[model samples]
Target chain A: MKLTILGCYAATPRTFTNPTSQILDIKNRLFLIDCGEGTQVQLRKNKIRFSKINHIFISHLHGDHFFGLVGLVSTFTLLNRTTDLHIYGPKGIKEIIKLQLRLSNSRTNYGLFFHELESPESEIIFEDEKVLVKTIPLKHRVYTNGFLFQEKIGDRKLNLDAVQNYEIESCYYQKIKNGKDITLEDGRIIENDKLTFDPVPAKNYAFCSDTVYNEAMLPIIENVDILYHESTFLQSEGNLAKKTLHSTAKEAATIALKANAKQLILGHYSTRYESIELFKEEAETIFPEVLLADDGKSFEF
Target chain B: MKLTILGCYAATPRTFTNPTSQILDIKNRLFLIDCGEGTQVQLRKNKIRFSKINHIFISHLHGDHFFGLVGLVSTFTLLNRTTDLHIYGPKGIKEIIKLQLRLSNSRTNYGLFFHELESPESEIIFEDEKVLVKTIPLKHRVYTNGFLFQEKIGDRKLNLDAVQNYEIESCYYQKIKNGKDITLEDGRIIENDKLTFDPVPAKNYAFCSDTVYNEAMLPIIENVDILYHESTFLQSEGNLAKKTLHSTAKEAATIALKANAKQLILGHYSTRYESIELFKEEAETIFPEVLLADDGKSFEF
Candidate 1:
């Protein structure tokens, strides 16, 4: 799995800082998240293939989260895109996009499908053979949802030596790998656990942003491999953060700690701070494995 | 009058090039024209004060022309702007903006007034004491209008020696400046022209973009001091330009020549061209005094 941070600043985009956008590549699928303004330029600077983005997920109706969506859709039409583009966001997103397209008189050459999300509870929003995506309800000024992308558990690995010792036929190897007991020719049964070893554990990532410090999402994102939470302010500005319904670095760390996430990534920083290091310094106090999100940064697992 | 090119490239914004956007400073009023995506960042990079822009003129509803407007409006609200913002655009622009603002539940602290235009003929859209803005209808794939900014004639300057020779009171200077013939004590008439030369002939600028080779605007923009016309393609791609309803560099120069404009500025270049010098080379063929539009470049007239 790979993740690329296109932009991570909060409130407004500046010459050096962008608002909020990211690209996640999991199981050969490229998913775009929260396309703020100037996202297309960022994608060009990062040299990411624009055609690879098939799915887009938006957290809320804030301009910093979804303003770049219509531009991207229009650019897709200009580029003669033929692949169906799926967009998942809160209700009313479709109207905003359709209105702009109508005014411009642009008809997309590809199918633009919108899956409006309105559920207030945790639910699986997308699932396939390789991955599953679920919504993590978040508390914000507007209706918001954070997405949790998890890889599906794979098949068990067969122990060739153990299978050979048990005189198991080649045809039974598939059953053994599927965690099923194998029957031998002598009417003896070979246990699946004895012939096979467990596969690598599934890895999962959770993205939460533009929300206040809330513990309701702890159970839904429990033990996630990586957690990206918004830290719009430092610990010193906790009051402002609370007033704005945004989280401080310490608050994001507390949520990561409570959820037992392996790694915590902090982003969506307010431009008032001179340096991003302050966020890392504050988050690391509670979560040992903490990283600060920077524009154009990439992480692989 | 000063003009700053924030972005001039056509179609999608790239890492090195931007879409259509400009700042026209005339008569102490800063006017933003055609805010494409990334315009706010460009304004920041150009060091233009965002608060000074009270009026915005959108030439069309294409994404390359007005995609950055909503973000700018949202940023204004975030910055606590109280000055009323006036926007002039097509008939459907008001609905597009209001719907997005309504969906986000953002009520602007400042008033946002929209002036919709659907006239096929030229008409004055805005007029103040020092400036006048008129629409120049253009032929494009969409309903579009080009803006003509003209500086209103100012008070005539009184020749100090001539006024003193006539022993004119200071109170009467205002009337003389207003082009009134001052009555002499001996019943001898002093002509207004003898007192003051005509205030610098009112300078006018015509902005035409995303249009084809249309001569209908010649009379409206006749003898303009500066003319900015879109040249999306070169002469070799005349067929493409004709099909897209866009002008070639040659066609833009032809319009400037026919209009008898003092100077011609070419912009809205297609990304297919490797160098901008090609546009200048082609335009200068028809109009000798031609300049290429470049981002961050400023022109004073």
Candidate 2:
């Protein structure tokens, strides 16, 4: 799995900094999360193909989180995109987007679909044979949701030497990889585990942002391979963070530590800070694996 | 008067090229015209004070012409702007902007007003003591209208030597500047022309874009000081320009020549061209003073 941070700042976008937006590539499928203003330009800077983005997930209705959505959608029509595009966001997303398209008299050549979420509980929003996506309700001033992306386990690896020793035909290799026992011509059955090796483990990633310190989502993101949490303020501004319903760096680290996530990624920094390294220093006090997110940065696992 | 080309290309924004957006500074009042995507960043890059822009005029409902407007409005709120903002655009502009603001639950502290235009004839939309703005109807695929900005004539300049020789009092200087004759204590009348010289001639600028090669607006923009017209293609692709309802470089120059404009600026270029100098060359073939509009370039008249 690979993740690219297109923009990871807070509030308004500036010349040197952008708001929240990221790209996640899992199981060779690209998923866009939280498109802020100037996201299309950011995508071009990162060299990510606009055509590869089939699914876009918005965290909330805040301008910082999803303001660039309409522009991106309009650009798709200008580029003559034909692939189906799916959007998952809060309930009002469809109305806002549809209004702009109608007023501009723009019609997409591709199939456009919206999956509006209003549930306050953790529920699977997307699932396929290779991947699963669930929403983790977040505590914020607005109706917000953070998504959890999990890659499904793949088929078991084939033990070529063992299969050849058993004189099994090549056509039966598919069944063996599916974890089925093979039978010889004499009707004697062989165990499935003895013929194949174990498959590689799957990975899970959780994205959380623009929320206050809340332990309610800990259980939902427990043992996640990677966790991206918002750290809009530092510990020195803890009071301000709470007053604004935003989490501080230390608070995000505490949540990551309590959830037992393998690594923690801190983002959505306020532009008032002189350096982002302060957030990393504050987060490292509680979490051992802490990483800072900047625009155009990428991580692979 | 000064004009800044924040972005002048056509269609979707790219990494190096931007869509249609510009800043017109006339009579010391900043007016934003046609805000495209990334215009906020462009404003920052151009070192323009955002607070100075209180009026925005959009030429059409195309995405490239006004996609960045909502973001700019939201950013103004984030910056705690208290000044009123006025927008002049097509009839559906208010509905689109109000819908996004409603869905996001954003209430501006400043007054926001929209002046929707559906007129098919020339009319004055805005008039102040210092300036006048009128709509110049154009032929395009949509209900597009170009704007004509004219600086009102100022008071006549005082000839200090001539006024002092005529023994005019300081209190009467204001009257003299207003083009009034002065009567001396000796009962001798002094003509206004002897006391003061004429004021600088009023300058007029016309912005025409996203329109075909039509001369319907020539009378409205006659003898304009500067004219900025859309040149989406060169003369080689004039047929394609006709089909798309866009103007070629030669056509833009033709309009400027027929209107007796002092200078012509060609902008809104299609990205298919390798260089922009070709546009200036083609336009100069028809008009004497042809300027090219490039991103970040500025013009003073």
Instruction: Extract clashing residue pairs from model 1.
Output: none
Best by TM-score: 2
Displacement of the residue A167 alpha carbon in candidate 2, Å? 2.2
lDDT of 1 by residue, B166-234 (tens): 998999999999999988999999999999878977899999998999999999999999999999999
Could you give the interface RMSD of candidate 1 in angstroms? Answer: 0.7
Worst-scoring 10-residue span by lDDT in model 2 chain A: A98-107
Docking class of 1: high
Mark the regions of model 1 whose C-alpha exceeds 4 Å error after superposition: A158-176, A184-190, B165-167, B184-189
Measured against the true two-chain complex, the DockQ scores of the candidates, in the order shown, are: 0.85, 0.75
Which DockQ value does candidate 2 get?
0.75
Task: Report how far off residue B214 is in candidate 1 (Å).
Answer: 1.0
Deviation (Å) of B209 in candidate 1: 0.9
True contacts kept of 2: 0.68
Task: Give the per-residue lDDT digits (tens) of candidate 2, residues A1-301.
Answer: 9999999999888888999999999998999999998899899999999999999999998888998898899999988999999999999899888877877777889999999999999999999989999998998878999999999998999999999998999999889999999999889899999999999899999999889999999999999999999999999999999998899999999999999999999999998899999999999999999999999999999
Q: How would you encode candidate 2's per-residue C-alpha lDDT over B1-301 as one tens digit per residue?
A: 9999999999888888888999999999999999998899899999999999999999998889998888899999988999999999999999888877887777888999999999999889889989999999988888999999999999999999998887778999989889999889999999999988899999999999889999999999999999999999999999999998999999999999999999999999999998999999999999999999999999998
Give me candidate 1's TM-score against the actual structure: 0.96
